[model samples]
Structure formats: structure tokens, C-alpha cells
Target chain A: MTRTVLEVRDVQKSFGAVTAAKDISVAVPEGAVFSLIGSNGAGKTTFVNMVTGYIKPDSGSIRFADRDIAGMAPRQITRMGIHRSFQIAQLCNDLTVEENMLLAGAIHGASGPSFLRRAHDPEARDRAVATLERFNIAEHRDRLVPELSGGVKKLLDIAMAMAGDTQIMLLDEPTSGVASDEKFPIMDLVMEALRSTGVTVIFVEHDMDIVTRYSERVLAFYDGRIIADDAPDEVLLDPEVQRYVTGTPA
Target chain B: MRSKLFLGATAAFAVLAAGSVILPDWAMFLCAMALAKGLVCLGIVGMMRGGVVSFGQGLYYCIGAYTATLVANSFGVSDIFLLTLLSALACLLVGMAFGPLLSSYRGIFFAMLSLALSMVLYGSLSKMSVIGGTDGLNIAAPTFLGWAPEGRPLQTALYIYVVAIVVIAGTLMRIYFDSEQGLITLATRDNELRVEYLGASVRNIMTYNYVFGAVLGGIGGTIAALALGHVDPEFAFWTTSGEFVFVAILAGYLSVPAVFVAAIILELVRSFSNLYFPNTWQLALGIFLLVVIVLLPNGLGSLVGRRKGNAA
Candidate 1:
């Protein structure tokens, strides 16, 4: 079972006059931290969105867990053990951290008599507590998401993606807008929390330091195309990659 | 804790039932009608909690009343329970038919679309000949399980019946607000996009909520029709739906019991203003709404507490 978890080949997408992804290909291993680095409008997010079924690639194939899911709905993709975390931490701000955890888990956990069933059924509650504890934010269990600090919010966002049987995750800028001092710790906590799940994570990030530190491999984007794909150190020093990375303060 | 809630609800309902027995005829009538209004407003609050402020709830309310009236007139069936069920069924069917279209909209679009649909119903009711047109249709005296009581006994039985329905419904609604489906409804208000990522169909969930709201609203309307012994085009009017929404906002969309409390307070406020100010009663309602909106942005429930995530 050395098969790739996700495969994207010759994917191309354009919005009227603007091309978001052009002649790109990627194959993520079963369980590895793969990072994408690019500047604003460099198509990193567009690529992630396409993989997660938010945007249909103009021409290409996207296979996940042995199934071609190129044109599926976001919900359908998520139900197939794939989840996406937003750049700004798309959480139910009106709900408590515990409530959010339970709500995320409720999708595939129970099905019948939703009105009569307890949302945080004993099993779901235990799993929620376990997830919160794993992310090291159990202290904020009863706290509203709006009351959370940026680091915790980011971690919670990723943790929510892990609440289900998420075999693959597409995290878009998990550390964006986070406090500089807390960024590494948040990423470290996320890595630690999700380590046991053996989840394959594909993250789009702008921070070179974070990309080099946590990711096993890196994909650098330039002009809506992948210019470099190798080990973090090799891709970091590549002349073409350096020009894109050093030229813009992404 | 669950037992405590169960017991507390039971105790509160017992007190209300007892109070209705000891109170005079006018007070009992007021309480019965207020409970019905509360039920309708509760449905609005249900949608309100999901960030969907519907102004077309009057459609279901009117359907509920008219369904009961039609069945009574057409088939001479006056069983209150059966009439309530028929009204709920009618609203459920209509809600299912229209829910898919309306669920895709949010904010002002959702609100205006709902208002427009209810207005369509209102216009139809005003022009229909078989449904008594603008003059409205008359409902025969309702019976309970083949026993049609007259005068005091009738009022007493109906009061008990209303109390039972409200109490049971309130309890179920409480359970619903805590359930996963209910929590997602609240979550839909927070971020529908995230709800979709969680692998739940946002529109479908909202549609179910809308249909549930319509069902309860229909039940409320049927109760009102039976209590008043009349069904009219005015029940489907925008103003009537506005009153339900106003009460929902005033109540803060906080809890099930709070809905009943808000409706009773609203009815009392209207009754007192009409007695004291006569022609300016509507003006008083407007002023009260303004004051409530300004003072309690979260509605009257916030006065107690605004605990985070208590989007009940």
C-alpha cells in the first residue's frame, strides 16, 4: 500500500483573463506534511481550493484515495475523508470550542432523529474532549471561538478538520494573521496533535521559515506554476525559487 | 440536570394550568390566545437563531387556520387534535415545496422573499370565494375526542388542551435546540461555509429548519383559529407576520420558555395600550419595539445573561 493519497496532473484553471493554475502536477505521499509557498495571487490557494473541490480545474485529473473527485461538491469531498481549513480560521464563532468540536464531529457520527439525539452524545463528547486535549486548548473548551487568541483559533481550525475521519487535509494559510511569536508554537501544536492520526496534510503557506521547519517537502509557485518541488533545503536555495521567494515579501 | 429541567418544566406547566382554572373568563381566553401567538413566534425565533429572519411565517399560520376551517366546513370534522395535525401537514407540504428555493437565500433576500410569499397567500385569501373571501370564514365550535362542551366547560377544556400542547412543544423544542441538527442551525448563522466543510449540506439543513418552523407556525395558527372560532385573511397579512418577528427579536431567541413569555408580554402590552391609549396602541407597540431594540440588542433574554455560544 505505497500508493499516493492524492494525485493532481496537468491541472489548469483560469478565471476569464486571469489564470489561477497552469500546467501543474502534484502527488502527495500517504502521510506527509507537504507545504506550498507562493506570493499573493501566485495560485497556491487556488491550487488548494481546486484539490479540495472548491474550484473545478479547467483541464486535469484530481484523484483522491483511488477516486477521481475533480468536480465533486465541497461537502462530497469532505465526506470522502477530506477536509479544508480556511486561511482566516472558518469556525462557528457563535459556538463554544466544545460545541464547535462536537458540531464538526456530528457530520458522519450519527444520522437518525437529529432533533431527538443529543448533539454531544457521550461518544462524540469523549472524542471532542480528546481532540481538544490533543490540540492543547482544552482550557478553552467552553470558551466561544470569538474569545480565542489567534494561535488557539488557528490550532482549533486544524483540529476541527481532524474531528472526522479526515485522511487528507488542505490547510490554507494556517498561520496567516497569527501573532509572530505564537506562529511556530501553533504550527508545532498542530503537528503534535495530528501526528497520531497519520493524516496527509497539504498546506499553502507564505512563511519560508515555517515551510522549511515543519514540512517534509516543499512546492514553490511562481506565475501560476510550480517552479520548484523538492526537499525544503533544496527548493529553498534553487535560484528560480529564491527569485520568487526573495523578490516578494510573502 | 436533565431531570431537573424536566421537573421544572412540569412544575411550571402545572402552575399555569392551575392559574388558568382560577382566573376569570377573559384572562383564560387571553392566556390561551397568547400561548398560540407564542407558539408562532417561537417558530420565528427558531429561524432567527439560524440568522434567517423570516417575515413570511404568516403563510404557514394562515394555512394552519384555514386548513382547520376548511376541514370543519367541508367534512364537519371538528376534532382539535386532528385539525392541528392537518394544519401542520399542510404547512409541511408547502414548506417542503418552497424550502429548496428559499433556503439558498440569506439576510434581506431571505426575509423579503418570505414576506412576498406570505403576501401572495394573503392576496389569494382576500379574493377566494369558497374560503369566504375578505369577510373571512367561520369555524364551528371545536370538539375534543367527540365531546363538544359548551360555555365554561368548553373554555376550561380548551385551556387545558392549549397548556398541554404548549408545554409538550416547549419541551421538544428545548431538546431540539440542544441536538446536533439544532446546533448546526446556530452554526449556520456563524459561518455557512464552514458548515459545508464540516460535511453537512447547509441548504438542506436550513430547509429542514424552515419546514420545522412552518410546521410549528401552522400548529400555532390552528390553535388560534380554534380559540377564536374564526379564520380570516388578516391572519396571513404582513402585519401579522411582523408581530411574530417583533416578538422573536424582543425575546432574544434565547430559550423555548422565553418564547411563550415574550408572546404573553407582547399580548399584555397590546391589551394595556389599547385600554389606556385607544387609537395609539399600534404607536405604543412601535415605540416599545424601538426601545427594546435600542436597550436590549440581544432581546430581553440578554438581561439575564449573554453566555457565549448560547445561541438557543
Candidate 2:
């Protein structure tokens, strides 16, 4: 078994008694494609927020690399080689694509000579080009983010996360709102990028095919708790996950 | 295109600075004051670019002016360089302490809260008669290296104006917005949750922004105090803060040079309004601002960028 990279124990979160997450516990091993599958309000986003230090759980401990990162702020956590992309592609709309990638690299504390061109430099133009090429949007590097289509924006958002030199990436519905045709390609590119970069991926996705295709391990969330954590086929076959997700086994 | 814009700004600054040498006393004075106000507006520009509006900048502005005025008047220390440095440090502390509180609020609430804070300082100053309260205190011409001005009022004002432009031009705060910290600042503006998830302390970034902004306001205030030769409680009024906001909107959230451009335009409006339409200049100014806002929704800075982009 791969060594565990993330551990969550008995985590609970509530907003004035409207419990968002309850007793959610899961472990993600290093270098694995971990998918957290859930319906709306299954507390999947909330759980992601908790692990990335966006939200502090009311009662629980989250350990990443054996350090309890229960209440740390997101930026501090980002400096530690973890990064996340928003569902809405939270990019600097006025900036060029290369600038966005450079900013990501800078945020992850990567800076040196030829910071914008060296292959290893996060801010290197080559790295941004590689990301844009991987996402099939290399032609739009000089363009502003606001001018891109929704699918392109989503792709660029993930590319920016890749540029950040992240060791662990938390992607929230990376394929959501994307065109049906572009979905698989984008997911393939993202999964391939993660595989090439050797970054541990924990993505929250709703589509079973995309999740099953990209994810090696699946953690099913139902009613704000993890109901099944196992291999993709096992989690898909689990009776509890089927009942909670689709009202029947797949 | 960006390089061209920077070049154009440098040229404009050169023209403005050179004009002071030949312009009339009233014209030079107006220009000098415009540059000073432009510097203050630059701080507002930075905050606004990051999607936070501060309506209380006058708090730091007033604090800066008072720090310099108090030391100069009470201790008879009139050194321009020392006074400016000391006052900026004082404003930096005030900004650091007060900035953290407003980092959590956004939109009108943040604006209003900042406005109220400045008003508090203004109110307190009015009650404290020792600081001359409502009347304010008069300051002598700043001594440069202990060399007293030889009754060269115009020359002295020109010197102050040059300093203001140089400081404003050299300011690299906007460049920081492009840095990692700057992206985080912008991220906080776009999506706080996403910024947090990226492992950045939104609050700390905000705090950092506030401290730098306060330093900008303090620098501007110090220059204005030197130019005006007085420091008053009115400097802390909400209207003063509002004026800075208006200037920032006029400049768009871009380079420091843009702020000066807007400030110069405003100064000309005030001057020409008083000159040709003295009776209704304020109303004319108000109408002009409305038109600018309506025409250039993004700001005058956007126009500048567009023109330069097209040219390039």
C-alpha cells in the first residue's frame, strides 16, 4: 500500500447548526487518483475546504504529511506544495495567460534566475506553454482570461494549478459546466498532467464515468459522511454507495 | 503596449515637472496640489484594484499630516526629509492596527466603516484644542539640510512638487499586484474561498495591503502638508477620503502615473471652474465626474490602456 498523504478523523463542520459535514473520515495515499464522489450538499466541497484549510472543522483533526493543518489559512498551506482551483476559474481576468501561470509559480515560492523561461522554473514560459499545450489552449497564452470560453477557462484554471508546482492538488468539479464533448478530453489532459507531474490528485467530481476513468480509488460521500472508500470498481459496486448515489446498484 | 504606456507616463511626468519651472504661481500651486492629491489617490487605486474600497484613508492622511505638523510645530523640527519619514512611520502603524479589522468586510460596509473611522479621528481632533482643533496649525517652509529658503516661495513650491511626482512615479505597489502576494490579493477580491483553498491567508494579505496603502497615504499627506503649509482636522473628513476615491475611479486601478493624470485633470477642472465659471464650479465638477463615469465605465486608466494598445 502507498503511504498515506492525507488523514481526516471525525471531522465535523456546521454553520449555526446546519451541519455541513459530520464525522467524515478518509485517507488519501500519495501518488493516487482519489475521487470524492457526492451529490449536491453531500459536503464534498466542505470536506475539500476542510483539508485545504479553507474552513476549520468544528471538531476534528486533519493531518497532511503528519502535520495537523486543522486551522491554517489557505495561502500558508499553498506555500507547503498544496494548491486548489476554484469551480468558477478564479483567474485574474485582466492578466494574460502567461502572467497567471507566473503568478501561480510565485505563490508556491518558486523563484530564481530565468524564472520565466527555465524548464524547471514554475514561472518559466516553457512551463506555461506546456500547461497550455496539455490543455489544448496553448494558442491563447497571450489572450486575457475573460475572453476565453467556459471550457477553456476551466482548462486554464487547472493548468494554473499545475504551474504552481503543487505536490497535492484539490480540484472541485473540474469537468462541471464543461461541454459534454470537451469533458473527457479535459479530464484526460488533467489526469495525464497530474500523472506526469507526479502530484497526488484528490478531485470532487459527480460524473461516474469521468471519476471511474481517472480515479484509481473512490471515496463516496453521502449525507455529509464518507460511506464507501475502496477501489473504483468496489466503491461503484458497494450497495451503500449505490443506494445513496443512484437509489440502485450500477 | 505596456512598455509604451510606461514611456508615455514618463514623458507626461517630465512635461508636468518642467512646466512648474515656467508656469505662473497660481498654476504651479494648483499643479503641485494636484500631484500631491494624486499620490493619495494612488493608494485608493491599489485597494480598489484588489476589490476593496477604503472610505477612511483620510484617517491615515490626517494622521500623517498631524504627525509632521506636531513635530515641526512643537519641537521646531522642520526638516522635510525627517518629517516625512517620521510621519510615514506613524501612519504605517495606524494603518496596520486599523486595516486588519476591515479585511473581513467587503463592498459598502468596508467603505462606510473606513469612512466612519476617519470621521472619528476628525471629531477627536476638533475636540483637542491643543492641536489647534478646527483652526489647524500653520507650518513653516521645510528646511532642506538646514538650508533655509531665501524667500523663494515659488521655488520652494516647485521643489515640493518635484518630490511628489518623483515619489509617486517610483511607487511600485501596483507591480506587487502581479506578484504572488498580489495575485492572492486579487484572488481575495474574486473568490475568498478559492484564495483560502490555495493556502493563502486572505486576512494577512489584506493586512499587508492595508499597511502599504497607509504608507502611500502617509507619503501623500506629508507632501500635501508641505505644499499647503498647514495641517487641519478637515484633512481627516470623509469628503477628503471621498475625493481620493473619486480620483482612483477616474484613474482606474492601474499605474501610479494614471493617478497623477486624473489628479491633474481634477485640478484643471477646479481651476477652470473657478476661473471661468466661478459661481457654479463645484456643480460643474460634479457633472464632469458623472460624465467621466458614464463614458469610461472602467476608468480613465482603461482609456489610456486602450489607446496605447491600439497604437502598439
How high is each candidate's interface RMSD, in Å? 2.3, 6.3
Residue pairs in clash, model 1? none
DockQ for model 2? Answer: 0.36
In model 2, what are the clashing residue pairs, if there are any?
A: A74-B199, A74-B200, A75-B199, A75-B200, A76-B199, A78-B199, A116-A124, A116-A125
lDDT by residue for model 1 over B255-286, one digit each (tens)? 67777877888898999999999999999999
Which lDDT tens digits does candidate 2 get at residues A109-211? 4442121232223335576676688778888877777777878888888877776658889899998888999899888878887898889999989889888
**TM-score top scorer:** 1
The 0-to-1 C-alpha lDDT of every candidate, in the order given, reads: 0.87, 0.76
Chain B vs. true chain B: TM-score per candidate:
0.96, 0.90
The number of the candidate with the highest DockQ is: 1
lDDT of 1 at B266: 88
Worst 10 residues of 1 chain B by lDDT: B303-312
